[model samples]
Target: MKKNALLDAAEALLSEQGTQALTLTAVADRAGVSKGGLLYHFPTKEALVKGLVARVIEEFDALVAEHEDGAPGSYSRAYVEATFEILTGEARAHRRWSAIMAAATDPELAAPLNEAMTRWHGRAPDEDPDPVTGVIVRLAAEGLWEVLSHTPELYGTARLDALKQRLLALTRG
Candidate 1:
């Protein structure tokens, strides 16, 4: 819980000011914890970044699982729905993820994120969908991510929600 609190603080700071404004001291200050207490949980900034990456991967995994456990066509449908949520400000947690992704140009942060993505994507599929279709859909989603990560107003939540619905319909067809 303490760790999550710290991550939450870090995410807010990162979103507001980017990696330049992030520091263990700042996280401690924002989280209302002592520097020593913060250090006790994460001995270094690198550790905290690693924890943040893990938190992102875990959250994404949870979202995937929630959709995967239900009815047919859930994977593609959930992917679109969950992504719409992320891009539409329905899931504010993505701001932190965008920050982390931006920070990842620095090796200290990038490595863990790379590893996490690798593991997540490398996982075996139960019944893999068409590879080409999957790739195209994922690329479209990536395009949406690019838009969301850069200009928050690039697309409104309603438009994105409708777009996702259309894409999911197409994917189902």
Candidate 2:
């Protein structure tokens, strides 16, 4: 519980105030825990950042799992749905922005994200009949995710829904 609270505080700090404002002291205060409590879970800022990244991955994986069905291209479909959800949801959008910014600034921090992507894409080959198409769909979704993250209003809600449906369609084997 304390660990999650510390991580949540760190994420909230990063998302709301950017990396410059993310400090162990601030996180400890935000979480209403002592500095010693924070240190118990994360001895360093790097560890806190890594924990935040891991939590994001875990939440994203859970979202994908929720969308999974026993069918060809299930993973691809789930990936598309999960990507859309993360990009559009208000709280998730902020969390993702923080994670992206953190990863962009530090190569070491990107390792876990890269590993998760590899694991997710690796599953595509086995679950998706036309693996190439699956890869393409995933790429398209990722592209959309990137663009939407920056300019969510680029495509209005209706258009975004249409695009999401189209991506889901591409997952059909």
Candidate 3:
């Protein structure tokens, strides 16, 4: 719980104040813990970043599991629904993803994210019966991620939610 609090503090700091204010001291302060305590959990800034990445992956995996269990056996539909939640800011790290992306400088720091992406995409069917719709849905979801990661301010949550609904509809069709 303390670890999660520290990671949450780090995400809030980075999202609200940008990377410049995400020092260990600042995170400890925001989390209302001692610097030493924070260090006890995350010995370094890189470690904190890794923890944040892992948290994101863990949250994403849970959401995917939720969708998978709901649909029972449709990978494409579950993947699309999960992607929609992510793009629509319904997912936990939707707003704070930039924080993790910014801190993912080192190879080790980036491995978890890269591995998650690879595994998630691997679950996407390589050859769908309706290739056109699948391609469209996949590209649209990827495009939303690019836009969300680069400049999310251009689209408010409502707009993103609307877009997600349309994208999910496409996936269904």
lDDT of each: 0.69, 0.82, 0.71
List the candidate numbers ranked by lDDT, top first.
2, 3, 1
Query: What is the C-alpha lDDT profile of model 1 across 53-94, one tens digit per residue?
Result: 777767766767777745444565666665665666554535
Higher-scoring candidate on TM-score, 1 or 2: 2
- Give the local distance difference test score of model 3: 0.71
Ranking of candidates on TM-score, top first:
2, 1, 3
Clashing pairs in 3: none
Candidate 1 off by > 4 Å: 69-73, 89-93, 96-99, 102-108, 119-130
lDDT of 3 at 72: 22
User: In candidate 2, residue 35 scores what lDDT?
Assistant: 92
Instruction: Tell me which of candidates 1 and 3 scores higher on TM-score.
Output: 1
Q: List the residue pairs that clash in candidate 2.
A: none
Model 2 alpha-carbon drift over 4 Å, by segment: 31-33, 124-126
Clashes of each: 0, 0, 0
| TM-score (all chains, Cα) for each model | 0.80, 0.81, 0.77
Full-model lDDT, candidate 1: 0.69
